[model samples]
Target: MISGPASVRERRLWMRTIAIVNQKGGCGKTTTAINLSAFLASETRRVLLIDMDPQGHATLGLLRDPSQLEKTVYEVLTHEQGVTALAEIIVRVRENLDLAPADVLLSALPEKLRETPGKENKLSEVLEEIRKDYDYVIVDCPPSVGLLTFNALKACTEAIIPVEPSFFSLQGIARQMETLDLLATTAGHNIKARALITLYTGRSDFAKAVAEEIRKHLGDRSFNTVIRFSLKLPEAVGHGLPIAEFSPRSSGCADYRALAREVLADEPPKFAPSRVEEDPEEAIAPAPAAALEQAESPLEPRMQVSPPIPVIGEGLFTVETPRAREEANSLPPAAVLEQAESFLESRMPAAPPMPINGEGLFTSEAPGAREETIPPALAAVFEQAESPLERRIQASPPMPVNGGVRFTIEAPGARSVQLAADFNDWVADEMQSRDGIWTKVVPLPPGRYHYRYVVDGGWQTDPLNVHLEPTPWGGYNSVFVLEGNNGNKVH
Candidate 1:
C-alpha cells in the first residue's frame, strides 16, 4: 500500500502532537494536517500524520486509497494490537512523512470504544508508545465534539483550529474553547491552541474585518500566517498530492510552508510527555488554573458591523495576495517546473491545442534562459491542456438554478446519479438523469452547503460551482450559498 524507502530509521526526538480540529465542517482541518505535515517533513523532520477522522480524508489526500488498504486506524483502535505493534498500518507517503490511514469502517469506532474502559485515553495510550519515533504527530480530527475528538485532544499537546473568514466560523470559537476547557478539566490535558485563518480571501473589507476581529479575540493564539483562498489548493487535493508536489509555484504551497516555519519557530520542549497510566475507576484530575480563567471569561464583543461576504468569488481566478507575490520569487524555480513538465508529458495524451498565456508562467528566468532551459513546446504543455475535471469549478458562477438548489454535471453514460453533501452526512442520494446530463434539486436552507455528485459509481464535483473546498477523500466539493430572507444577514 505504501511506496517509499524501506522503514525510516527510528530516532530519539521530542515529539509535538498537534490536533488540527474544528467543530465546523469545510474549515480546512484535513487540508492543514496533510500539507503542514508535508512541509514539516520537507524540512527533514520525521512526521506521522494520524488520520483520526473517520472520513479518512487525510489518508486519501496523501495518495493512499482507503478502499484498497487492508489495515487502517480502525483496526488499530479496535483491536488489542496498539499503534506500537501495528507498524504495518503506518504507510510511508514520502521520505519523512508517514500516515496511519483510516477508512469508512472507522465510523463504527465510537460505538466499539464506548464499552471499552479508558475510551478517551485509548489514542493517547497507543500514541505514547509510538510518539518517540517521530518528531511530530499531526492528528486530523473529525468535525464534531465526541469521543474521537476527545481522544485526539487528549493525545495532543497543541491544537490548530482552522477558521474560515466568515461570521459563523467566527462565532463558533467560543463553543470550541468551552469544549477544550471541559476536556482539560476531565481529561487533565493542557493543550496550546492557535487559531489559523484558512480559505481566507483578503480582498473584501468584510473578510478582512472578520479576520482581524478573530485575531483580536484570540490574541496570541491566532497564527500570523493566513492560508489565502486558492483554487490550486482544491486542485492539489484532487491530484492526490501535497500542494508542493502538485504545484510548487501555487500560493497554497507558499502559505502552508510559512505556517510550518511558524509552528517550528519555538523550540519543542526537551522533556518527553508525561505518560499517565489509565485507571478505569479513578476520578479525573482537577482543572488547571488557566483553564478556570478561560471558563470564566466571555468572548470579546465585536464593535463594527459585519458585512455580507459572498459565498463564492465573483470571478474564476483569485488575484495573488502580496505575500504570495513575495513568495513567488524564491519557489523551487527550474527543478520543480521541469519536473511538472516531464510529468505532464509522460502522463497525459495529446488533446486539442489550448494555448497557454506566456505571461502567466511563475518564474523570473531571463527570456534566453527560459527558451533554452525548458523546451517552449514542453512549457506550453504545462499551461495548456487543463482537463475538464481540473477546470470544472471555473466553468460558471454559483447561482441557484430553480426554486430549490439544483446541481448539474455532464456525463455521457451514467446509470444512476447521486449526491453526497453536508446536509446528508455525505451519503449518496440518487438523482434524475436524461441523455448525457444529470441533475439533482433539493430544498436547502439559507446557509452555505458543500456537495459533490456521484454519477453512476464515479464521483464528480460540480463543474459550474466556483466555491470549492478540499475533501478528505482527495477531491473538491462544490459549495453554494442561498441568501437568507434578510438579504445580507449573517448566519
Candidate 2:
C-alpha cells in the first residue's frame, strides 16, 4: 500500500487512526475511548468515535441509544455494500465530533464474516474510503479476541490499552503484548501499543505502589498521566454524556484533558525497528579513553588506553631517606634531656582561664557596650576600606539587544528535528541531535514568534516551553518572546 502524501500541500491533512483495546472487562477501556475522543474533538478538530464492540458502551456513553438507531456498526460490517453509505449511518454527537453507533446485534459479526474472504481487511478497506474526512478516528474494541477485534486491529495505526491498578490487570499486560506480537507475525500489521492507567486512586498506597511497578516494567510504553478515580465519571456515563459536557470542572474532565495533551505531544508511534546488521568484531567495545573522548561523535571508536597507576601509597613498601639516619646518629645528651622534659609537660593538663568580662581587654559596665562598638584597631581598618580612594567601580555586562535564539529539544527516537515556524516559513532545515539533544540557534530581531519542532515528519510543541498558542489544526505552536530589556521575563 502507498503511504505518505503525493504533494507538499496534501501532506498537512494526514489522519491518525487509533484503537482502544484490552481483553479484561471493567478496566475502563470504553471510558478512556469516549473521554479521550471527546477531549480531542473539544479542540475543534473533526473526530470520529467508532463503537466496534457489540456491548455498545462507547455509543451509549455518547448519548446515542443503540435501540433507537436503525443502521449501526453491525449493519455496516455485515452488508457487502455498506461502506458506500457510511456517512448516512454515522451520527453527529456534537460539534466536530461524530459517532458510529453499535448494538448487541454486533455480537453476530464473526458468524456473518465466516464465509467471507479477506474479512480481516474489510474494516481497513471501509475506513480507507473515509479516512481523509476527519483528523482522528478512535475505535472502541471489545473485551474478547475475535473477527471483530482482528478487523479493528487491521484498521488501526495504534492501540491504547487501559489497565486498572490491580494484580489481575497487571498480569493481563503480558498476554496483551504477546497477542500484539502474534498479530504482527501472522497478519503483517505493526500496531504501536501504549498502556494507560485508569481508575487510579492516588490516596490508596497499594494502588500507587502497583501503578509504579507497572510503569517500571513498561518503561516508555506506559503513559506518564494517570486517570484518577472520580465519582463524576460514572455519573457522567449514567447521564449519557462525556465528562467534558456533563461536569466540566470535575477531576474526570481534568484527567482527560491531561491525557489529550500527552497524546498531542507524541509523534506517530514506531511499532518496530527496521532491519540492520553489524559485524561481531565491530560491535565489540573499544578502549575506555577512546570511547570517552569520541563520545560526541556518532560512530564508535576502535582504540583503547591503558589504566594509570596511583602515586600515593599505591605499593606495599615505603622508601626511607639517608638524611634521617645521619640526623639520628648526631643526637646530643642535652637534646635528649630537652625531649624528655617536653614529653613530661605534654602529659600534664592545663588549667582553664578566668572570665575576661570584668578583668581583661574590655571592662565595660554592660555587655551591650562591647557589641555596639567595634575595637579601635578594627574600626580604623574598616574606615580605610570604605574610603572613596579605595573603592572600585566595576563594569557590568551589556544586555542582549538582538541575538541568536537557541532552540534545543531532546528526541532520542527521532531521526532529525527541524525548527519550523513563521521565522523560517516552516521549512525542514535539518538539525542533528547530539547525545539525544537537538539544538539550533537562529539570529532574529527581538520580538514574539511562534514555532514548533518537526521531528521525523511529526510536528510537536516545545515541551520545554509552557507558553503555547492553540492552532486551528487541533494542536499548538510553541511561543517564544524575546525582549531587549535586561530584566524581561521569558515566555
Clash pairs of candidate 2?
Answer: 287-304
lDDT of each residue in 312-382, candidate 2, tens digit only: 24221122324433443365634433322222111111101111111111111231221212211222222
Against the hidden reference, what TM-scores do the models get?
0.62, 0.52
Across 324-414, the per-residue lDDT of candidate 1 in tens digits comes to 3344334455543443333222121111111011111111112222121222222333333342123222212233434566556656677
State the TM-score for model 2. 0.52
Residue 446 alpha-carbon offset, candidate 2, angstroms: 65
Off by over 4 Å in 1: 1-11, 80-84, 269-446, 450-491
User: Which stretch of 10 consecutive residues in model 2 shows the poorest summed lDDT?
Assistant: 350-359
Best candidate, TM-score-wise? 1
What's the TM for model 1? 0.62
Predictions in order: lDDT? 0.63, 0.61
